[model samples]
Target chain A: DAGVTQSPTHLIKTRGQHVTLRCSPISGHKSVSWYQQVLGQGPQFIFQYYEKEERGRGNFPDRFSARQFPNYSSELNVNALLLGDSALYLCASSLVSGDGYTFGSGTRLTVV
Target chain B: AQKVTQAQTEISVVEKEDVTLDCVYETRDTTYYLFWYKQPPSGELVFLIRRNSFDEQNEISGRYSWNFQKSTSSFNFTITASQVVDSAVYFCALSAPIYNQGGKLIFGQGTELSVKP
Candidate 1:
């Protein structure tokens, strides 16, 4: 079975622009979570959705938002992007909230 | 607040040598989970192992092994007879059920392991 998949593996955007990153969770997985990883740093949690409902959110600002569809696919939207927002956005899928997660290759967003 | 610490920023070892990566965590919750992930140059976080608070048993899978110690609050990973394939950035993470955070994972800074042939 295919693992979690992300689209637009790489992207470049200007500051103050908006961008959307997409993720398709593994088949039979119900939970999807988002994380942001800065260069030379580990990933930081962003948001998590289960059964199309927001279950958890990290310390990110209001500019960052995410939603999960009934099929368990997810999209992370970032508005008013700042140069600090440039990082690797990763998507992970899990069977349950506390279970092990399977991660995607991640979308690399570069804000210039 | 929960925190995971990976003191070693990077380590290098020759082929067939053994290497151990250290991880220390802090959490007030009595129940929680610990995890180890490997991010290769390709940039995908691969799940390696997960251990819970109740089980402290050391586990070994092929050439990989993990030591979870509650007394020291450490979960260390070791690679036996390491190979170039094992070179990657290894991360240690912790998760606990917080009021608004649910069980979101808090990751450490990660340890970059370089295996030389």
Candidate 2:
């Protein structure tokens, strides 16, 4: 089966701009999670949605938000982007809340 | 609060060498899961293994081995006969039970491995 897929493998935005990243979960998966990975650091959780409901949120700011669709696809939105927001945004899917997760290649976002 | 620590920032070894990456975690949850993920230059997290808090058994798969010791609150990964292909940033992560924290993973800073062929 195809793994989780993320859109716009790479993109650039300016400060104060908004960005949206998309993710399609694996077939039969109901949970989608978002993570931000800064250079040389491990990924940090942003949000998780299960069955189209918000399951959990991380330590990110209000500028970060996400949602899951009926088909289990997800979208992460960042508002008023800052240079510090530049990072690799990863999407992961799992069959259940805490099961093994498969991650996407991630969308590389660069903010100027 | 839960946290994972990988004290080794980077490691370099020649091919055929054996190297162990150490991971120490802190969590109050008696029931939790530990995981190992390898992030190659491709920048995708490749799952390696996941062990439960109740399972202390060591696991071996091909040239890779994982040692899970609950007594030390540690999970360490060893790559035997390392190769250039094994070079990557390896992460150790911890996750709470399903009902806790939405199963979000708590990851360590990661250890970058450089294998010289």
Candidate 3:
């Protein structure tokens, strides 16, 4: 079976722009979560969704949002990107809540 | 609040040497889960192991091993006979069922391991 997959492995955006990162969870998985990892740092939680409902959110700004589809796929959106927004966006999936998670390779975003 | 701390920012060892990475966690919940992940140069986070609060048994997998001690709230990983292929950034994480946050993992800053030939 395939693992969680993320799209546009790499992306570049200008300041004040917006970008959307997509993720496809593993087949049969029902939970999806997003994380952002800056260079030389561990990933920080962003948002988590289960069954198309928002279950958890991290210490991100209002400019960051995410939604999960019925198929368990997820999208992370960042508006008015700043230089600090540049980081690797990771998507993780699990069979249910409060379980071990599998993470995707991640989408590396660069804001200039 | 839940937090994971990896005090070692980085460690370098020659091939065939053994190295252990330290991880300390803080959480009030009695029931929780701990995990270790490896992020290679390719940048993908790979699952290494998971241990619940109830189980304190140390695990050994080939050249890798994990020591979970609830007494100290420490989960340490040891790599025996380390090889250059073992070089990567390793992360320690914690998860608990908070009021609204379920299964959300709080990750440590991560420790970069460099194994040289």
Which lDDT tens digits does candidate 3 get at residues A48-107?
A: 898998989999999999999878899999999999999999999998876779999999
Count residue pairs with overlapping backbones in model 1. Answer: 0
TM-scores of all predicted structures: 0.98, 0.99, 0.98
Tens digit per residue, CA lDDT, model 2, A4-99: 999999999999999999999999999999999999999999998999999899999999999999889999999999999999999999998988
In order of TM-score, best first, we have: 2, 3, 1
Question: Model 3 Cα displacement at A10 (Å)?
Answer: 0.3
**B8, model 1: CA deviation in Å?**
0.2
lDDT per residue as tens, model 1, A54-81: 9899999999999999898999999999
Model 3 residue B29 distance off true place after TM-score fit, in angstroms: 0.6
Task: Identify the candidate with maximal lDDT.
Answer: 2
**Top DockQ hit:** 2
The residue-level lDDT of candidate 3 at A37 comes to 98
Candidate 3: count the clashes: 0
Q: Give the whole-model CA lDDT for all candidates, comma-separated.
A: 0.94, 0.95, 0.94
Best by TM-score: 2
For model 1, how big is the CA root-mean-square deviation? 1.0
Where model 2 places Cα greater than 4 Å from the true spot, the runs are none
lDDT of 3: 0.94
